[model samples]
Target chain A: MSGEVIRRARGAVAALVLVGLVVAPWVVDDYTTALLARTLALALVGVSVALLTGVAGMPTLGQTAPYAAGAYACAVVGSRVSDVGVVQLVVAAGAGALLAALIVPLVVHARGVIVLMITLAIGELVVVVLGRWRSVTGGTDGLAGVPAVRPFWGLPALASDQGRYLYALVVVATLVGAVLVLLRTRAGLVLRAGRDDETRLRASGHRVAVHLSGAHIAAGAIAGAAGSVLVVAQQYISPADFGFDTSALLLLGVVIGGTASVGGALVGAALVIAVRDWLFGVLPGHAPLVLGALFVATVYLLPTGVNRARSRLSEAAAPQPDPPAAQERATVGEVGR
Target chain B: MTAVAVGTNRIDPYLIPALDGVAYGLLVFVAASGLVLCFGVANILNLAHGLLYAIGGYTAAALLDGGWASLALALAVGVLAAAAAGVLLAGLLTPVATGSHLSQALLTFGVALAGGSLLVAGFGPDDPQVQVPATLEGSVMVAGHRYAAYRLVFIVVAAVLAAALYLVVRRTRAGMLVRAAVDDPEMVACLGVSPARIRAGVLAAAGALAGAAGVLGAPIIGPGTDTADTVLLLSLVVVVLGGLGSMAGTLLAALAIGEIQTLGVALLPAAAPFLLFAAMAAVLAARARGLAVRWRTA
Candidate 1:
């Protein structure tokens, strides 16, 4: 297919996804609606991870820091303002980006395990602070009494499961669109390069740190937005919600989904949630064991992610006429070594 | 007389916690030593290090119901089990040894999660505590203050273990090969030595050490669902803070962190939780890489 045709097809797929989300609430039952809302928010987090770890070549175990920041920001803002979901979400995203900015310098130059460890530490630090500052965060019990989400000032409050689910869907779809657009920009190209070869980028006189900072900030905003949606959907926020497990789960989702693709984030998120909820029902008490096994299997057998299987099938069916240079560029990019 | 009294008063407050801190520090070293060795020699940071520790702890706890000889046997069994786990992990990781550390870390993390779940399934949700043997269960006087004799014995045992480990790594032929592999695995392979075998050996040894620490130190922290995760986090911190592939650095950092943790808790309860992370952040801020190995692939 030609470039314009491929772009149009991509846009059509995105639009279909948005439409499906819009109608999903009415189609599914209340229970699934609530579940879908939570899953979408979590998938947004996977998108953020995909951006930083997959695209930017900086794997983080600390995406939860921005996530928790957004959650807390929403909770704090909700307590002051009666019903301002949109405003609260904006503030939360800004908070997440700000927090990421503060943390970038600490981890910017570190590589591999160092980056992972520092990010993990930053996550723990946030948890510790949230737990210690009881007066603000409500400590271990978490903050309660968050007002029902209002999409805007005049819209009806999202008190019902369907309302909240729709709210979450709209917010997540917008963020996903934003991320997809961002990933096609010059900054995204630089990030992809940085991930592939930082030394080369440095030699070329590109300040690698600037690109990294941009990726982190963008990731932070996405995660923060997810957090805000999550708080509104669940109507609660706690320190436990944004712990090591959540961070691990988010990273796992990205890896499982296809870190290089936006759709992979959504698929990965949906799969993880299904494993947690549906698999729990199927296996009774062995959900974690099953999930762990799945993770191992995914890493060992499907290193490129589940999406690779579909992409391969599609390629076999309808192979595009690719120019040799694109393949050469892909080989050169070699995003994650 | 007033000057002496004031000096004693000032020193008296921290003296006991400091001693306790030393014991805790020694245990941390024991737990982290194998991790450091594995990273140094194999260039693979095993996230399941904590699970190994917990395995040792659970085995020792389950077996400590018998007499003194049985207790010793239990410790040996725990160490062996952990070593076996190490071998299995090494076997699994060998295929992907050349991959990025992120993937390696994720794979090991999956192993940890599975192992942790299995532990919870076997032991239930309750924390498992090992009963200290009658001989080492008493209290000892330290400047007129009473302290757990078991903790003191633990400090001694760990110190002896540390010395033995240092000597073995520094003196033995096997240790020479291990060190050579750490420096350059390709060169060692060229010299007709299989670096993979050496790495597996180091991993087993490290696993044994972690197991020993788990069993011996389980009495202090106890074994539970969170045990593996907590230990993994701390060991990762120690590995990073001490710099990869540096045993001495690992030991010193562990001891200092142990003190900082204990003293921080005793002095300021509110700030205690953040102390380790705070220290780590400060170190990384001052030195971007902290203490880093020569060859790092992230």
Candidate 2:
């Protein structure tokens, strides 16, 4: 297929998915609607993971730190301060950004697996804090009965499951659209350039660290906003929601989605988390086993990712002097060493 | 006289935890050594290193029965079992030998998740009991404080193991080859030694070390659903803080971590949870800054 044709097809599919999501609550039961809302929140996190792992060349398992920060912040704000959705979201994003800013020094200079380990440590520490800080976070049990959120100041609070699901869907869509727009800007170009060749970008006087810090903070903000959506969707939040497993699964989902594609990340994360939730309901003890096996299979079957493999097939027809993908793989291999 | 006694009493409360820290630190060192070797020599992250440790832990839990013969048998079985698993991981990693760390991590993490659940299924979901030899199961007096004999045994065992590892790495021809490979794999390959075999050998040796640690440290850390994650996190912390490859650095980092977890927690209970990662982030950022400075000057 030609590039134009593939792009058109993808647009059509995305449109179909949007329409389907809009009507999903009506088609499915309340339980399924609630689950989809939760999935949407997680899928947004997946987008942030892609922003760091793919675009910024910093594969992180620590986005959850900001995510948890946003969540707990939203929960606290929603209960004591304001029950307004927009207010909670802004606070959550600020909270997430603040946490990301705090850890920027720890992660900004690291690359490859080193970034991963540091982020993993940060995420674990956040979870530990959440588990221990009983007065604020309600400890391991999490904050339950978070007040219902009004989408706007004058609007009625979301009461029904479908209402909450629709609210989450709108929030996710708006944020995802914002991210897509952000990526089209010069800032995104610099991030991609830095990811491909940091030394060259630095030599060009791009101020690579500043751009990376911006991207990191932005991703954190997006993840934090997702945390507010999560608070609205479930009306409960806990450290369990932001465990290492969630981060791992989100990273895997982003990979499956084609690491650099925001849309792919959303779909990929939703599918993975949905599968996990479904497996828990159906197989009980066998969720990790099946999901793990799927992860291993995905690595072998779609090494580049679902989106990249499809594009690579089309790009194969016109042979170039050098493929950037191959170069990327080589550089990644070197970085690992 | 009163002031002197008061000071002694204040210091006396922390004596056992300080001793416990040494034992815990040594166990972490033993477990983390395998990770250091895998990443340093083989260039494989081996995220499943914790699962390998858990294999030995489960073996110890199943086999040890509070007898000397049981202890010997458990060590043998644990070492063999974990080494076999390591060899299996080597086989699995062979295909991804030249892949990115992300791919390697995905594969190994998959194996860890699947393998961890399988172990849980086989061993049952609850934490399993581990039996130490009858003589070592009792407490030993140390600095006027009674400490668990099993934990005390770790100090001696770990010292002997560390010495053996040091000698092997510094003295043996195989160690020379391994170090040579790390410095320049292409040159080592040019010399006609099979790098693949060396990779396999390193993984097997790493597994044996982790297995032995698991079996011996089982009485302290125990076998449970969370054992793999806990051990993996600590080992990664040690590896990162130790500057990735140096054994002496790894040992010191592990000891620091051990004290922080035990003694630091005791000293500042409110800040206990933040101590380890705070220290790690601080050390890593400082090193990165130092490297940036060096790079600029050079």
Candidate 3:
């Protein structure tokens, strides 16, 4: 449709997300909201993942390395050294970014599946080192009993899971919102263009490798920050927290929900967590079989993801293109940089 | 006295141990074979392949620990059980293999997650170990020290299996079909072979290999969540280092990596991982494009 309508629709979606963030915790149980809080904390990684994979076409398997880095940094810093939330987050991001910077350059020139293989290998390396390095990581069982991170300006406590979920909710919301805005900016637009057509962008004189490197580090930073927040909320840090399984599950969530929109990450996260717990109770030996089957079906039926599929199906049924006026109105939508 | 004697005699510590690395290498080979088959043949980088290994360990542990009627039966059932699971996963993954690697990765990752959950639920997140069969236990002298007899058997069995695979792939009709299938499925189909059947058979074979490795190595690795991720990484390292669709490369790579891991640990216990990564990084950097090459023939 017209640019004005499209802009307005975007604004509406933003409003809906904001409203949902405020009201959602009031209704859902402590476990789900906490899980959602984890998802929100975790979604920041997805944002960077969407940036790199959805836009830049890099298949990275160890997004969780950064997440684990951030988590452990936050844990060690928050619990052992200090309780300041800001310091923890900064350390998480800084540590993650530093690690990503070191490794991403090594594989920056790789694309598609190779990037994933390298990252998955890195992920294993991170876990293995952490699991073995007893002095820093506390070894295999993980560090338990991290304090509830912080309340703003020396505020009073919400110590229970519900209260912690609410606190985490605010942090996750602000970060996710900031990222969503950042993705709407010039760098994001350029990355999307690079993803869609790297050669053409390179022909137009953009340093594609440099851009990919930036996205890789940025993703790690986001993941690291999420890990930091996770440590705060869980009040526990263990090798198990940032295990490869966590990375795989998050990636699985992205796959189930499809990657085009932020909502897909959310849906994927909720579906993944809920299914695991439910299956734990019900599925017995057939758990992998069922999950694998579900994933396979999702691929065949809605490869573009649920929302994309819905949009496509609806558009197919409606048989109407956006009005010329609408298309003409939002040149800003095309404006990336 | 033994340690002093061994140190004074100065027997070639490096060489025999290097040979000793062969047994460990063979174990990794059997373990990685299933993954190579799935990754190259089915074109699915199944994230949950390690979970299958872990499950195999658990299956062996449960049967052997739970007082199953026969140790041989437990091993057989454990391997078959894993193969059956593979067949089931093959059915699930066949449709999605055509999708983006991300989707395939996610599907498999989710399965891995669910697999972990199932493992925890069933085994209560505790470590489970399969008792070494009496026949497989005890040690044989290798590098001035007695090594596990089972490991020697492992080396022999894995070597035999690898030879059989080479023979099958090189000399047999099925090998010819698989080689041709890798090049072009459409062409293979036109040549009067069912691609689906071949794919299923390869996947099942992969599962069997993974299961056997899991059960056999359970005493060494144990039944745990670590099984999936570690084995998966090793498999990736093997197939990639060796180059896809090259059994020789897979074997050689598996041995090299196995040696790297063991020797690295032997030399530097705390810093083995970095050494591991450094080796891979050097290799990958040396041949930037010699990674996974999906051969598409017109």
Candidate 4:
């Protein structure tokens, strides 16, 4: 129950999850492998959601806009320009970053629920454009027959479900690792500070909006890269794939994972999306019903998130004189009041 | 002279869409007013507001049979049903009332998702047809363009509802209490009226408004799988654009949105989808400072 022991346990659990992911494609059936690949792509998007929602003090449902931009861009470039996964990823990331940059002005000043609403609108608008822009996007039918992607030059193109799953896993791990490293930097500290108290950060002469805008672009790039992986995994892209439901589910996944933890976001999002895909496969029309129930239960039971609950347990066992994290959480809870 | 003539010709084809915008805007106003009140007074962002509206839409679809009596029955049933749903939501929200907006959103969104699926399960997955009253089902000539009579009736109904709401909020003791609660819940609580009751009452009223909009607007928006999302998004846009609490601002924002959705689409079909959000982002970004101040104070 000590903090050190809790950290070690978390490390061990992460390693076990990684090992499981690495071996999953080989053990699972092709359908499950494909599903896992899709979940990986979505989980990566969840990391970006957490980056903004947890790290930067902005809860967004519009990451899908940049995600879709990255996806369609990757799909287009994959078909016409290159099939190399790296090239597609760069294009997708650039597309996503560009879209995020454009939207920075709209969201930078907004806080709390206003950001959520604005992002929700932005996300819906992207879907609308995707559904209507048939000439390039193929309308609601989405782009199909996206060429297979090679992980690198001279590498064989992904052909089987297992191959695609491994490709997605590797990409997700690399991007997630990058995000983890990035969050340990000064930029992350500033973002967390701003989240805790923007007024104090501003008084300290920090350009809070600039840091947020940077975080927004970085998250967009990450989501966009994930979109490329999604195209690679599914080999088809459509507006329905990035609908409001996807954004909502991703947000819930972040909440479940602990909004402030990147690893938690990854796992939580994957778990949520995986469950949804599985439920749809097994239960057909009742997926939303179950997922909705899960969301409500998550809110009620895991008010702070799965990660936070564990930390709280550890803290309770080894009580601290004054926990800054707990105090920060208290401030976060006061948002929108 | 030639340019002006071309402009007139161009505008001729969009007259109906322009009128449709007015009707659409009014519906959005009705739906969003409830959201404004809930957020403004109760400070609870009810994501299930759309579900409440859908309840009304489904009720209208189920009860209306193109008869006057059916219309009256649908309105009554829809309002009552949606009001009850709102009260249920208030009960559900009781625990999370003091939680962050995220928790409240998650809870309400869950209710919306669960309630939406339940409605679908009960009503079937397909978009159900809604029959309006026989007399109002027909089209009427307006400036030489034939328009749906049902849509025209929205203008009158919405205007009356808006005026009544304005009066109630401005003149009645309950209205003063609601305003006082928004400004200072502690002060309102000190006066002996439970803030919880006010919260529940506000949600119920909001639900009734949404239900009425849903039932009346059913012929246009319809009860379907996508209805809840569409209404929720539009109402959210209206509420945000209108700056949350002010009814007049909400009405204006709704009207602008209706025009953009209808007339803007007609004028620029190629750029139709990007129009609404683009305008929203532009307006919000332009007024960011004002909005931040307003949000802080609100």
Ranking by DockQ: 4, 2, 1, 3
Per-residue alpha-carbon lDDT of candidate 2 for residues B1-298, written as tens digits (9 for 90 to 100): 9999999999999988888899899999999999888877776767788999999999999999889998899999999989888888888777763535667677788888888889988999999888888888788888888888888878899889988988898899988888787666667878998878988898998899999999999987898998988898899889878876567989999999999999999999988878987888778777876533321111
Model 1, runs deviating above 4 Å? A2-12, A305-337, B289-298
For B146-232, candidate 4 gives per-residue lDDT tens digits of: 889988997788888888988998999999998887776767888999977998999999999999999999987899988888898
1 or 3: which has the higher TM-score?
1
Interface RMSD of 3: 10.4
Clashing pairs in 3: A1-A326, A1-A327, A2-A326, A2-A327, A3-A326, A3-A330, A142-A238, B50-B228
Give DockQ per model, in order: 0.36, 0.42, 0.21, 0.50
Candidate scoring better on DockQ of 2 and 4: 4
Better of 1 and 2 by DockQ: 2
What local distance difference test score does each model get? 0.78, 0.83, 0.69, 0.85
- Model 3: lDDT to the true structure: 0.69
Q: Candidate 3: which stretches are off by over 4 Å? A: A1-10, A23-36, A80-82, A147-167, A274-297, A306-337, B1-20, B54-80, B110-136, B224-226, B292-298
lDDT of 4 at A115: 78
Error of 3 at B114 (Å): 5.2
What digit string (tens of lDDT, one per residue) describes model 4 on residues A109-190? 7676667878987898789889988899999999999988998999998889999999999999999998888889898899
Instruction: Identify the CAPRI category of the predicted complex in candidate 4.
Output: medium
| Predicted candidate 3 versus true structure: per-residue lDDT over B1-298, tens digit per residue | 8998787566455554555578768877888888877766666677778877887888878877433355566679878977887887777667753535666676677566666767777886678766766766688887566777877876787788778878988999887877776665657778888767876787788888888888877776688756777788887777656666478777888888878877657767767657767777676667654442221110
